[model samples]
Target: MGSEGIMKDVTKQGKATVLALGKAFPHQLVMQEYLVDGYFRDTNCDNPELKAKLARLCKTTTVKTRYVVMSEDILKKYPELAVEGTSTIKQRLEICNEAVTQMAIEASRACIKKWGGSLSGITHLVYVSSSEARLPGGDLYLAKGLGLSPETQRIMLYFAGCSGGVAGLRVAKDIAENNPGSRVLLATSETTIIGFKPPSLDRPYDLVGVALFGDGAGAIMIGSNPILETERPLFELHTAVQEFLPNTEKKIDGRLTEEGISFRLARELPQIIEDNVEGFCDKLMGVVGFQNKEYNKLFWAVHPGGPAILNHIEKRLDLLPDKLDASRRALMDYGNASSNTIVYVLEYMIEERLKNIKNDQEDHEWGLILAFGPGITFEGILARNLCA
Candidate 1:
């Protein structure tokens, strides 16, 4: 960690910048109305109460559609996946191993293509996923699939939930900053479709997870320096903070069962974000050399966990009306893909910047990407336009 003269403990290593970003989703599309009305009804396995409750819960997320590795039609066609306690952990793991790896490879290909270079130049790989394939390390599969050099440094980060997305980026930032001429490939894939409407689980959390979480993969490249040949807008890392709040461990829980991992999400999560977000923002802004008057200049690329969480963060941070637009819109379009969500938000930001630049409008300079997970893990990245 070098020093920009901000805070001594916060590492200041080589400057890291985002060269490109790309996302991929399964071919199957599940609409909210169908999932809430038809799919849940079919999978609830005669539980009318669960179906009604799920419909109400899905509405709250404000998510219209989500991509899934297995479609509702496929779920209905396959008894093992649709029925309760039918598929063994081994079977489910096999399914996700292929689905998640393929998704990751697809997204990684997009990122590499955007970077416009050979994978031989990639120095390191950062892989993030909630899906725990039966195999020990899926990083080798990704590297092999992408034709990366066998000597590419591999750092594996799997099963961190939604927060893992930001966590992977943190690893990439460190690797890029600490090593010159470094190229870190950050990728995340989630196969949440396996957990969709599992009847062995209890109420509320299971239904909420079923209704809200979606399936997809996303990837991006982080470099020690920007790709000078490309005109891609640069996102430079300025601050990275990870805070584990006390006494909030039970707020969000993910446990393993015979069927799959069940999610136990408490209703107090939005309140938790509201309660502690200001302090998080304070730390980030101070480290980034932001003054009170400069707050408006900051854009937020937030994890669209749900509409409620986004709303709470917006209100707590006192951000502009449209500050959280990208998060909300991404959720609306793609649902919450857990660790894959932050990339969706970042993709949105990049797309917006590209649009503005093409239209000759002003591009945003400062931004913060935030993700919350099981530990009440509050992850934030203070970033700015690299050219600025």
Candidate 2:
């Protein structure tokens, strides 16, 4: 079928709209100013240079605090997790599977409550994670934990990195729009436990992970043709697109081994994304017949991969300073919870819009949600703010 034909058919019934959003974080909150001391002490690392480098990263990342699944109790229980060159994948998976599942259940329940719908009404589940590896995956565990219907259709996306949230939303949009009455609960959970390790010059990216990534889960309820009596539509999903830059696979790479997962990010990742984001976004907007729309006139929900990525995007698009307030606020409050970060950004946007509505202020109707992940993949979604 042709692209225009598919777009028409998809919107014939109605576009998928976000009904609600909720997020949850683990109990241990680490203050960035104190993270270096605790991290080094917990890992038994005495190298002053490595500690200094991490301290610098902590300040530069602009992350004030972050919640993590790892704690003194967990580190004490599984000392192997903090040891260098130790084969602790089994132990890591055990901790992460339980952590992610519980967080997912908590976030999902919050989302369902905000959605003002019975749990039984949800017909599908889309679970995304990059922190756990096990048989049956986190989806089955989440389904059981939430007491969802045994017949609920389930799809699990693993190792999607930072783009997993938007990727899952794209998947849920397809299911909701095509299946008529189907409502999808999209959940994303992540924990650094899977890749936690002692700071070493041999693996500089581990330090970056420590300074940036955090553990959390985010959930959103999605469905089309909302019943006005019960459902409140926040953002209408208009068009979604995914693309990858050529030969940039190595720029953002993660590998699973006996020691759990290890990630390596190139220094040029921010520059690479800045170079291509404009073209990618232009293409997505064109799909919805807004080819020449001004960028600043729309709301933005770009993933806060880090301070650098957000800065690069803001500059490249010539966006006003306030244009990325929600994104920056999410990063400051929660750090980058990988796939869960975008959910927090959207929630912040919604909350701000609600406040603005109360004060009789206006907001942009059209917005773009963007995220980058492994494979140098770019995910973009054009959405209309129904709440505005």
Identify the candidate with maximal lDDT: 2
Over 194-214, each residue of candidate 2 has an lDDT whose tens digit, in order, gives: 988888888876888899989
Give the worst 10-residue stretch by lDDT in candidate 1.
1-10
lDDT of 1 at 246: 93
lDDT of 2 at 257: 90
Candidate 1 local lDDT, 1-388, one digit each (tens): 1112112233334578788788899998888987856665556565677667877887887999999887655555565766665645666677788888899999999988887756766889999987865555778888998888888999888678889999888889999888766678899999885465454335555777777888999998887655464425368887799998998888888876677777777888999889988888777887767765355678888998888898888777677887888898899999999888888888777777777778887667887888999898999899986532
Error of 2 at 380 (Å): 0.5
Q: Residue 333 of candidate 1: its Cα lDDT?
A: 92
TM-score of 2: 0.95
Q: What does the lDDT come to for candidate 2?
A: 0.90
lDDT to native, each model: 0.79, 0.90
Kindly report which residue stretches of model 2 are placed more than 4 angstroms away from their true locations once superposed.
1-12, 291-293
Q: Tell me the TM-score of each prediction against the true structure.
A: 0.90, 0.95
